[model samples]
Target chain A: MHRRLALATAATLCGALALTACGSSGSGSDAAGPAAGPVKLTFWSWTPNMDKVAAIWNAAHPDIQVSVQKQASGDDLVTKTITAAKAGNAPDLLQAEYQALPTLVSNDVLADIAKQTAGTKDRFAAGVWQQVTLGSDAVYAVPEDTAPLALYYRQDLFQQYGLKVPTTWAEFADAARQLKQKDPAKALTTFSANDSGLFAGLAQQAGAKWWTSSGETWKVGIDDAAGKKVADFWGGLVKEGAIDNQPMYTPAWSKALNDGSQIAWVSAVWAPGVFTSSAPDTKGKWAIAPLPQWNAGESVTGSWGGSTTGVTTGAAKAGHADAAAQFATWLNTDPEAVAALVKEAGIYPAATAAQSGGALAAAPEFFANQPDFYTQAAAIAKNTAPAAWGPNVNVAYSTFKDAFGKAAQEKGDFSAALTAMQQATVADLKKNGFKTEG
Target chain B: MSTTLTDRRRTAPAPGTTPGDAVAPPRRTAWIPTLVLLLGAVYCLIPILWVVMASTKSSGELFTTFTFAPGSGLLDNLAELSHYRDGVYWQWMANSALYAGAGALLSAALSGVTGYALAKYRFRGRTAIFNILLAGVLMPPITLAVPQYLLMAQAGLADSYWSVLLPSIVSPYGIYLARIYAAAAIPDEVVEAARVDGAKEFRLFRSVALPMMVPGLVTVFLFQFVAIWNNFLLPYIMLGDDHKFPVTVGLYSLLQQGANAPALYTLVITGALLSVIPLILLFVGLQRFWRIDLLSGAVKS
Candidate 1:
């Protein structure tokens, strides 16, 4: 028994030492991604169908070769890009979601694409263009796709209740109550407490520029007056039980959408595809509209989910910055590439030219022959207010999600969640060695 | 045996208790343990069952139909999965098989050799060495993966099979288990006699001690086998080439894209359903060789 105890104790120490003594033998070698003959550039992306776009570029330029490797996971890709950037051996190009643009920019992982390429920033929508830009001409990523906020509602239910589409936020509140009064079991919409992206977009629509940078100092204003106004409007509706309180895109929300208890969903452009694919039964009854706003005369919008491809700092180290930039621009702006992304990936194209005359603008059959979805989304993409996501958006989102969930249960003020978000963001910025003014 | 023991003790005080008491309704409380074990098995099998039924669904039938009700698109899903990027799913499965199968085999052998030496030989710092290995078992895989990848990168082994395979082959837990198991299973007298009879140390270990440690070594191999097979962080960090990815990473990337487009979810479900077959088959094929109780008796003797 003493021998067994000694052996057990010995094994535990051995396990700890094994970890300390082991070394990664491959640190000597450089994963520079450099090539001898054709200028080979490694493109890391989690985006499906990026290979087809790379193949097109590879087929076009014999002197320049592009190889696309799908990262094992999106989170892995981000982690790898940061690690490689620190090690000075980053990939030539990589995919970054629009929300993570600030994270990448703050890490100095991205090469300034605006300076790399002469012009063509104007080709993409302004709101999307905001994500990749720090200051004028300091754009680090090119816009690839955008998910503009669009209202999708049960048209049959709306018509049954004698409700017309609300053109503004005031009208939307009235309809939410009117529709609920017509049928006590029904709600006009639902909200997701956990979905910070949707809330970010709504805050954007309310003209809250959440992040601001000025010569190494930054300020976060997630709970600004405009944002609070919008939140209070929704919070009042929440207290009145006009809207169903449920997380969007969940199984429960899907069930609610199908059953007509929740008649409308204000979501990203991707929701139409999700609705069609997830609930084929709700095919013809759904329709799309631009998101309602506080101002009756104004038509402002917001963007939720989107992605961009950027040249990495290591591209310069490998002497392929030009090639990488060329590929990124072509992948986003080239008609064939944009068409393929739309058709294969169901991505709502961010390029103005692609959405204008390309096949993407054609009415989708899933929307019951709604011709205005692509056009309306493209228009919203242009009008979307420029809002910046901080490097600590993940932390801020969590802070807000927790507070927001609590607020919901207690019937408390929703804007206070954003105040918690602001405090967390400010503290995180200070911890990360950034000068915080607010 | 435990139930019967308790049953015998409980009824021993009853006067005129006959032999029939032993055979009649063995123990009323036997059903409790049986029911508990059956519940545990069902809990484990529920996901397997759900995936089995889910694999049979079409894209349209996925969320609309009752979740567990099997659909008719099983063959179609298989065909589609096979046709995806020229059946890359099979390559992932084959890669997982290679990583897990070969990693376990190599780890088990190394563990056996090291375990035998640590158990049989009286060397300095043996306890210290064993303790360190036990501590390694406590280290999280995620904590080690980045450093392992960086080292693999330094050696120019990143994105290669060696990076994943080499790190996996040296499982401290496996080695520790083998040491404990070998000490219990192989008697010291046997090794001493083998040495006295003019056998080399290597010859004695290979021919005598190895055969005696078969049951324990199988356990070591299987422990490493499942550990390496289901590991996501290691390969997810080390390897970049999707062609080199195991089924877990492949299905993960597929599932990520599937989150946006629910149509690809069927492919993910089907791939998952098919990936578990090899491990199940492995367990069944190796069941006959298990004689782990030999160590318990050998230790007492």
Candidate 2:
């Protein structure tokens, strides 16, 4: 029995060591084998939309196979990429978010795809090109989609409440107030109290940039006059009960969106896809309108969120790096493919040439026959303020979100919250070694 | 002597026997304990229930209808999740099994040997070694994971399975439990008898003392199994290849996509449901060996 138990223990330990050895040896062998294939490109994307990309690639290029490793959201993608890079086994292609561009660039994990694609900017929208560009020259990402916020409302509810589609923010606020009075149980608009999404949208309309630069210094204008004005207006609207302050992932939020408890949603061009996907039962009840602006002839168009693709610095092969860049560019700028993504995946094309295709021209009747949806979004995209989004954007956003949560739930002072966030934001940026201008 | 040992194990007084009276108080809280257990079970099962129900629905039916209402897309969602990247989900599951199964086995064995030494022998640095091992338990995994990654990178082993399994095999809590179990269960007399019968120390430990430690080692195995199975950070930090991901990381990446493309929610839910199978099977199969008495003192009968 003693001999048997000792042998079992040794055997188990040896087995563990052997497994580790086998794993190491296998990875070593995989290193020498055709890293590309049989031409298998390891593509990591953090969206279900990646399914569409995979399908498109599979349908066309059987020989040049693209294997997509799905990751959830940009947050997950960022975490996974960092982990993979640390591990010395990063995927060749990474689907990165536009806001996270600075972090990826500063971390030096991304390859400069600009050198690979000479003069590829001509095919992409102006805003898309501007967003993908860092400091004045280096391009870190190839733009995949552009989303300009639009008002998605229930036309049936609008007619019931005697509300015409308000083209301006003031008129929209007025209409919202009347609707709130008409039914005390519901609000005219619903805004996530903690989210800077609406504020970002408003700032874009006012042509305010989040960050500005003068060759060497980076200045954050988040608490600037235009932003403050926009913040105060929204703060006033919240006090008036024109909107419902709700959390994003709550059951109540989902219910409100579906049952007409909330009548309108201000979202991006890609958001319609989410809506159809989220609440399919409310199919014919929705219509799309160009986002209501604070002023007529002014563009209130701003990016709520967008994603791009980049090659990791830890890529196994240099040739694979070129392939990744090629794939990213093709996915972003290919006219036929971009249209397919827009038409099928509902990703609004960031590529200028793709936006003119039949896919963008054909409006889904489910969205209340909004024929000029892409055109309006294009106009918004053109006027979007070119801000130098810093690496601290996510950290600042989370800090402000917490303060927003406190104010909304705990009924704390909004001004105090904003002031605290401003201070914390400056401290965070300074700590990260980013030269910040007060 | 055997009867005396059994008597010592029974702490509960017989029913109808009190200090001076003819009747005794009940040892267990009958209805109250049962009620509390039921409530605990319900609380643990709610999120699991939601995942199971949600996995059955199409993305369209996910948030549009009642949350708990079952839909008809379980097989469809599974099919899609399976076909995602030529069935990478199964690869993650296999990797998780490798990490948890092999990790737990090695962990239990190491704990047994180290624990037997600490319990049976009086050594110069035993207390210090035990204390150092215990201190490892208090250190947050995140604090270690970052440095571990950096260290692995230096060794050029960061992305491999060794990065995950090596760190897991050295579980401090497993060693601590093994020590306590060894001290209580393995008798010095039994070791002496085996030595007198001409067995060496290692043979004595294997033949006589090991059987006594079986119940405790089983507990260590289960504990490490669950720890490795549910581990997200170590694998999340150490591996970049989606093929090498554990189910937790796989499900997390799937959910991230669902955030932008809500249609993937079905896949995330279905994938989460699929990930829990091995763990459930492990717990059920080895449950008899999970003697709660080992936590207090190893049962010797």
Candidate 3:
């Protein structure tokens, strides 16, 4: 028994030592050897048909072959990418949302590609370009697509209600009220607290820079004057019961849009794509207009969803940074690539030159009634307000969902929810060891 | 012999109740417990029913139709799912089967050996090892996904089939179950008799202990198979290639195709409805083993 105990103890110690050695040896050793023959790169993206678009490039560029690995999009993808990077197993290229750039950059998942992507800045709009640069000299990504905000309303419904298309927030409110008086059961639109991106875009159109960094300090302005104005305006509408306070993207919301219970949507360029499936019964009945302005005569709009193709730090360590950056640039700017992206992936190219012609020259099938749909979208896209993002946008966005979701359900003060969002965002930034300013 | 004893015990009435009372019919059925059970069944089945009903609807009709109403797009949805990315959905289905099927078989084999040794042996540090495994059973596998991914990365196995299979093969709960089942089902005297007969240890276990532990091992296999089949986070984090994704991750990728495209709700619902068929078939096929009591033909008291 004694001898067996000694043997067991020795075996246990050896097993424990082996485990610890395995754990410790994982650190360091990120150096890559010299490449040979053709360079193969993997790209992670959530865009549908991205592989088809990449296949176009792969056929042209035989030396630097790129493959697209599709991923589920959203905030979860950001966390997944960061985790993969920490393991030094990140893909060569990643398609990231414009807002998630700061988080990825701060995590060191993305590499600075300004040197490789030089002379491509003129390809995108100024505001769209600013997002990829993050107000820095280093460009972490190339802008692939932009979703400039617009108002999509039912032309027949508006005409029936004798309501004019709102060009300003005041007129929009009046129209909502007028529609409510005409039919109490029907709502003109809804205030959806479920989508933080929608609220952020609305606030951006009001000129609220929710996140801005200078030197080494970050500032969170989620409850600033412009933010409060936008919040209060929507709050007043929801309080008065002029519009619905329900969430979007729900089955009920889809039913409403399909059956014309809710007649208008303050959405972005991608609304047509959503309507194609969600409100298929209402095909060709919707028309696009610029998002109602905060003040009259202002032509500014905000983007809801857009993404950039960024080269990962792992790609750089793997000696494929230049090849990845070249693909990223060509994926967004090259006329052939962008057109294929538009045709196959159904993206609104951020490149100004490509946004108007080629694949987008004809309106989307769902918007066949509106012949100049892309023209109107392009005009709105030109005036997109610049957006600022911090490393903790995910935190702020979740808080927005919780705080504002409650406030909207209760028809309570949204300004208070906005304050909670700001406080939570700042606290998170500080907790993450970021220097924060009010 | 033990089955007869259990049968007699089940038929025997309560000790406090007289024979006349046992023969008497109940005044009324237990409506409250019956109602509660009905509610529970509905609660568990509503989501599954919703998936079934929703899968039949076309994309346009999915949200517009009534909740339980069936539509006419089941065949279309199936075709779309089959043709998606040139039948990548089937690839994901095959990958799920490989991960769950092979992972469960290996886990059951490993658990059988470890559990038999722990239960039947009198070796030093046996209690310590068993206790460690108990602690492991308490630890959720989701929390260890990132650590496992990192370790797999170090071994140059991160995106490979082995990365997922390796971690899944060492299920603590499976071993724990097998140990308890082994101790109760296999009597000490049987092993002593086999020893006096000069049967080797491996021969004794293979011929005697393994046969007795079949029911418990089947339970473990089913549990591990279902756990691996429904696993999302492990494979989601470990594998970067979509072709290697299970149906859960593949359906998610289809649903969340960025803000540019509408979610493929119909395809996802159809995929979900199809994915559960294998699990149901597996349960229906293996359920007979669970009906066999562990000590059915063992020594009488």
Q: On a 0 to 100 scale, what is the lDDT of residue A360 in model 2?
A: 71
How do the predictions measure up, each by TM-score? Answer: 0.90, 0.86, 0.93
TM-score pick, better of 2 and 3: 3
lDDT (Cα, tens digit) per residue for candidate 1, span B17-75? 75456445554666987888889889998989999998999877776678889998999
Tens digits of lDDT, candidate 1, A338-391: 888888767777788887557775777787467776777677667877768777
Off by over 4 Å in 2: A1-42, A49-67, A79-90, A315-323, A339-346, A364-382, A410-416, B1-42, B48-61, B64-88, B121-124, B298-301
Query: Tens digit of lDDT per residue, candidate 3, span A1-438?
Result: 466445444433332232234223343434344467788899999999999989888999999999889999999999999988988889999999999999999999999999999999988899988998999999999999999999999999999999899999999999999999999999999999999999999999999999999999999999999999999999999999999999999999999999999999999999988999999999999999999997899999998999999999989988789999999999999999999999998999999999896899999999999989999999999999999999999999999999999999999999999999999999999988999886
lDDT by residue for model 2 over A1-438, one digit each (tens)? 456455544433443333334334333313534553445677777655565666686677765567776655655457556655655556777877777777776666777777876788887766667777875587777887666677878888999988988888887888789888899787766657655655565566666666666665667767766666666666667766777767654556766777788888877766666666665667778877777787786655676777787877755344566666777777777766676666655666677666654677766555645666566666656666554476666766776788766776654455566666667777887887778886
Give each prediction's DockQ, rounded to 2 decimals: 0.35, 0.28, 0.44
User: Sort by DockQ, best first: what order?
Assistant: 3, 1, 2
Off by over 4 Å in 3: A1-34, B1-28, B291-301
lDDT of each: 0.77, 0.71, 0.89
lDDT of 2 by residue, B111-133 (tens): 88878876777645557666776
The most accurate candidate by DockQ is 3
True contacts kept of 3: 0.58
Candidate 3 DockQ vs. native: 0.44
